[model samples]
Target: MAQKKARKAESSSQRGKAQKKKAAGQAARAATRSEEVSGIQAFIKYLKEVRVEFEKITWATKKETIGVTVAVLAITFFFAAYLGLVDFSLTKILGLLY
Candidate 1:
């Protein structure tokens, strides 16, 4: 019957639309997966470069490191003592004035 044929045609068109939508969804998922892979690859490449640069560094010897630490400690103690003396002198002078 003509009505039966028309129904079949309508059903086929709907199936075609559904198939297209499914294919588009699959393509979008594929694109997103590829982007994630590329991002991971870029990060791995950056880490490799950082490792290579780290290997090229010239670290200080133990003696040099100790010398620098001692110098820093000496300077810190000197400044601390100087500041404490200044603060105590100022406090006493202010107390006398008050």
Candidate 2:
């Protein structure tokens, strides 16, 4: 009868250990879920901040944009022509030397 009681106690102890391990696993999973939720919340907050900053920007008007674009194109063309003339002149001088 004492041996039977010892066996029952040992079995109960093992079951208790298993239950504790299961609880620990559940707690860890809960912590992971909370961290995931907090990460998503932080990303949403960052996006909201970006949107607020975007609204504060001063965008150029269509007329100003067109004027700036035209100025840039004109300057680009002028530089391209100047560089082409310089390159041609250098090539002719090098040819004569050779």
Q: Looking at model 1, how many pairs of residues clash?
A: 0
lDDT of 2 by residue, 1-98 (tens): 99999999999999999999999999999999876757788899999999999999999999999999999999999999999999999999999999
The CA lDDT at 81 in model 1 is 100
lDDT tens digits, residues 1-98, model 1?
A: 99999999999999999999999999999998877757788899999999999999999999999999999999999999999999999999999999
Q: Give the worst 10-residue stretch by lDDT in candidate 1.
A: 33-42
lDDT, candidates in the order shown: 0.97, 0.97
Residue-level error in angstroms, candidate 1, position 72: 0.5
Q: How many steric clashes between backbone atoms does each model show?
A: 0, 0
Distance from true location, Cα of 42 in model 1, Å: 0.4
List the candidate 1 regions with Cα displacement exceeding 4 Å.
Answer: 1-37
TM-score of each: 0.62, 0.62
